[model samples]
Target: MKNFILFLFLFFLTNSCFPAIEKPDDYFYAINKKVSAVVDEPEEVKKIYTRELQKYKKYRTKKYLISSKYVELSLRKKDKHILVYELLKLNDDKYDYVSIACNYNLALQFEFSSPELALQFLNKAIQLDERSGEKYFLPHLYHQKGRWYYNKKNYKKALFYFNECLKNLNRKETLYVASMHNNFGLCFDKMNNTKLAIEKTRKAINILENKPSKTKEERLFLYFIKGNLGGYFFKLKDYSSAEKLLSQELNFYITENYSSEMINPSKQLFELYTITNDKEHLKKLIDFLKEGESRLKTTDRIEINKIFQKYYAGINNLENLKIYSARLSQLNDENTSKTTQELSETSDRLNNFIIKNINQQYAYQKRKNILLTSVIFLAIITFAFFILNIKTRNKRKHDSLERQKMILENNKKMLEKDIKLQNEKIKSLYHSLNLKIETEKAFLNSLKNIKKQNNFQTEEVLKDLLLKVNNLIQVDKRNYDLISECTLQNEYFVNRLSEKVPNLTNLELKLCMYFRLNLSSKKISSFENTTPNTIRVYKTKIKTKIGLDRETSLDTYLKTI
Candidate 1:
């Protein structure tokens, strides 16, 4: 009985000392932490957002749920627009701003279904934020409203909301500040304030880069800013700077298979290449364009046509050049015609709205009895007409959606095709490179034999042959060629090493690069024109400076990087 009582006491004490494990669905405050993610299923989403979110209010999860899946419910061709409606039904005095965020999110998802619906939700978000007496989500609410106006091309109004976003963002809110600066940059770009746009984008980049930990979305924003910087540099006619930024972005996009975002960067690079007379890069640009021709929008095709126009002209191929020029002109003409047609349709709609409103007012005052009878009789006929009109509109929308889906599907296929072509080209280039190297070796061998056959008397002939061989076999000039190429190739390795060992000199940096390439002590010594013993001393110094122990494999560590 004593033992049992003691055991029960111990168990209770242990339970009191350590808190219970948090359930997966338990609510947790992310006060100082970044946002958490959303669940995938609708039932979970409803339980979390519709019920749990309202229960905890603004002090709970600031974003309610951070899922791109929830965002995607707003896009696409189908007509399921229930997310916002479901969220709006949760509005109450206690959790006003929480409900407000739901409304804004709903607006964002179905902004395409109706502009009025989006505006209605946006206004509700603002109103709820004002009434809640908490600035918890005011910045985010302002940002979303800015986006709405920005999408509508209302630059001034967008700036108003963006400025509001900035005011609420304290210095410690680096994420919000970075986002605000980024959107402000986009606004400035759209308004044609190129200088401000560049400044804002660079500010955003600086802010995000300073953060110790960045999410994938933050890194993507950095990539986008770099690409935007490239565009701005292109506008300023700084081709060299533009080429560097755009090329880095293009390389990332191609390697990561981000085909949707590749089009503009590719076009910008093409423009830079055309002007710089870089036929090698220009040929690559042409390949990318041709491979994506079916997927290109009017603007994309126009840009590509311009590139071909320059390429053929450079080669003095007049016939092909003329053909491309005609295509370019045709694309431009078609774009203009489409723009005019859209404008005409918009004007007709406005005129019809005005006339119908005036007739409704006049008929009510001028002939009340007759108008009433007519409205009653026409109501039945109008109901049937309304049903038919809805059917027709829905069918048209469905067809349009199908076309869009087909275009995207075709784009994916084209991207895959281009990737295959690129791989083949790389293989062919590798073969050509090997052939060139072999030919150079044979040529050098021949030179040696010829010199020997001539009794080796001609110093000038021997000197010329040696110089050509030195140019081909660049290891002797290791600092100039091998180290530079290695540095460019293993950027992450170089960057990490520099950060770890900031005091490293130029020679020490070279030692690190050699280590990164898994070069032996003897090979590194030979490259540095030194003895193996001297190379060992350098390696020890590097390992010590980088805080790695003797047993740690420096080369293996670099390989992981």
Candidate 2:
């Protein structure tokens, strides 16, 4: 029992000391890459949780070294506080490598936030990796540098890095090749090289399709490629192809609830429908847009508004077109101003750094450099400084212009609000006037009802009054004939007939009443002192207007009514 207890205690102690096995170097590198994709920087605690490099030997292999170097680089770039603690704990030999790699990574980190520093670190990383023969990470380093250049809108340099990545593609790195191709397509698309963009995107799609299974990241990229293809077709005005691809992409977006994929296809469809002059299809597309607009978040509303504006313009709905266009213009102005301000700030920082560097160089050159070289360097630096300063001032001026634009937008919005209020008032007044007119018509109808009721009580008196009133109003003789003939035996039938034939001429109403009572046409003609042919003609006209075929018995239909 003592021996068994000792064994169990030892097991527990070992297990407690070693909580969990750390993942392989490749695994940590992949995890770090994924985290970097979604977040600007991972927190120190998150990095500590994710990275378990201490569990493994420090200098296992060139591959492990590179991966470990990347982890430290990522942590330092993110400015994780844990880095200081980790650095202090490392052995001297490992510390030397970490220090150099960390410095190189620091340069890369600054490349995004501070390009000058990024260039310095990239150079250092290249030099160090060259000495160590750690070329496994060169592709990634190049890709990142390319991304930096892309952000700076230096397309040619970005392409150079992408091409470098392409050159490194092999059987072991198929996924990387696919990713580079996708990135290349994006760059080409931005540069408006549609043909090359399509070619590269197609290549990406092919790679994704052949893969047995895809991660979520791969699927997202695939969907993006599909959306781009749809856009390409749309731009070419091959709308049938555009619609098919866009519709497929739209379905995918709906299933995934991806807001980013919703608007472009909808706008493309709207444009296609407009071009085709398919009114029914256009209406359906409009309903789709409205639904998407309602579902979209506030950040996506600008895109929704753009689509709506295009749709409205296509339909020639000028009022809404103008409203959305104005809104778009306001948003653009605000964005432009913000961008200009940011650029100016960045330019100012760059200028300050340049000035400080120049001053330091002057100090050093005073001690070491020859007179001619120093003069030439100073002249070049002075010219560059003045040019950069001018650019900064212009950017600031642009920002000021943006501020003026905001003021104008505010005034425009106020004016629009006043106009809207006035329009509402006008609509309200029109409605009120319509109601009044309806009320007057109803009062006149009630008066006519009262006159008819009194006529039933005193026939002789009513007749004399009717004759005098009809004469004064210049009532036609035919109207009297119509009224006289419409007197039916049943009041219900008379009331219903009156309701049905409200706009009927008096003669026609009378004929209708007789017809409803099952009176023969000849008998009606004799009663009315007219020819049977005339009665037949009037009945045919009434039947045609009422949309009743000759086969439908008018008398029977009227009786049922």
Candidate 3:
């Protein structure tokens, strides 16, 4: 009894002196902290994340539950479809915006593949943030929305969203800001604002280059921006600077074995070599191209083959030129067919998704109507029992229910109309794509026939053949259907303009319609795949033809007409 009392006393004394460390039931947060610390090292981040995921078979917190699955799904190297479906399955409507990880990530997955779908996800995230009154992720979300517009080729909208993104940022000197500038450069480049493109890209490069202890991702981005700056220089005919920058980029990509990235620098260098007649560099680049032929995509292969054909033609190598010409024609046909098929499949998927959404909404509406009816029945019964003599109250309640029913009916009709319009748009787009494919096939067949002609062997003959192909393609006529549709929507604006000018060409009429839509010269150039300066010259010609004074605004005048 004395020894037992002594042992109990010792145990109690020891427990009081040194307390045990308590482990958290929700230990995933701790693992998350560690993962964040080593995020710059992808391998270590993956290892730590995998270990924590395996250790925790079930997460105790909502945020970690979604976050862990996000990490796991990302590590699996899944495509956008699988990522979207899996992440959406994990989303709970009851959870707060901060607790859900799928919204932003799913937006990223859809950004490149289906920008329309990506916009919906981005808008959902923004809505959630607004509902929660939280501005923490607003900047990132705005940046993503800007990317969505950028992918859709709506540079003006992209710039608007990017400006919003910058406005929300707490710090201007960040990787995100650098990324924004890089995006602005790309947008400006597409708009044929090469000088502005160079400025923005240089700003991005300066920001990244000046950062101390740069991360691997940042360094890679800097290389990409430099390569893009080189492209801008190439556009400006600054061959010396372009060659220097592109060479460095090519070396970086080669060392990293980035096959897809290799194509851009290679393409630019090939063009530069052909222009400068640099046979020495051409031989070296040709070797790289030959080695990487199997890895390049069909479209890229076609592009390089054309370059080779041009290079060989310049050197009077008839045999090699003919070989490349044949290869280019065949590759063009194959790529056209493949692209057409892919577009058809994409259209089908989009239609199915839209139809599925409509069906879901219809079902939801039916359920809502049933529930509303039940509530009204219960309310009427209660009113009857509580106020049997109050006929006015009963009448008012009945009128209110009728109004609600009318509102629901109106909403349902509007939704149906919207669905109809959307389906029509999809069908129109599909038809246009098919039309383009047919036109390209015709153009390619014409080229093949021209090449087979005995008279096509001379330089002048080849030049004439290219000019004939250019005339035969009828690019302006190809876009006429789209313009016609726009005209119909704009109250026959094209027809009205043609009547008013009486001397307007088809292209000038199209330009007038574009101006009437309030499109900028930059936007018009992008649409026509021409330079802004060329578009400006066309604008001048239109003003002269329309008999407008120099002081009058052409776009504003067209809008009035």
Q: What TM-score fits each model?
A: 0.43, 0.41, 0.47
lDDT score, candidate 3, position 436: 62
Expressed as tens digits, the lDDT of each residue in 276-315 for candidate 1 is 8788988877887677676767876787787777777678
Whose TM-score is greatest here? 3
Best lDDT among the predictions, by candidate number: 3
| Residue lDDT tens for model 3, 201-261 | 9998999888887866566667877998999999999999999999999888778776666
Candidate 3 global CA lDDT score = 0.67
For residue 288, give model 2's deviation from the true position in Å.
2.8
What are the lDDT figures for the candidates, one per model?
A: 0.63, 0.60, 0.67
Q: How many backbone clashes are present in model 1?
A: 1
RMSD to true structure for each model, in Å: 32.5, 35.0, 41.1
Model 2 Cα lDDT, one tens digit per residue, 1-561: 122222322222111111123333235435444544544455753454344454335443434434454455444545553463344234222423444445444554465468876776666655654454434345555666676677788878888987885775454444556767877876887798878887887897888878888865566556666767777777777778777777777777778877755766676677777887878977886677677776776546677777767777666676676666666554444555542444434333433343334436676455344444544565567668778988999999999999999999999899769545643443443344445455556556655866777455566656655654555343334334333333233345656766875545668766876676566788678678999899999998777656578799887777555
Tell me which residue pairs clash in candidate 2: 482-506
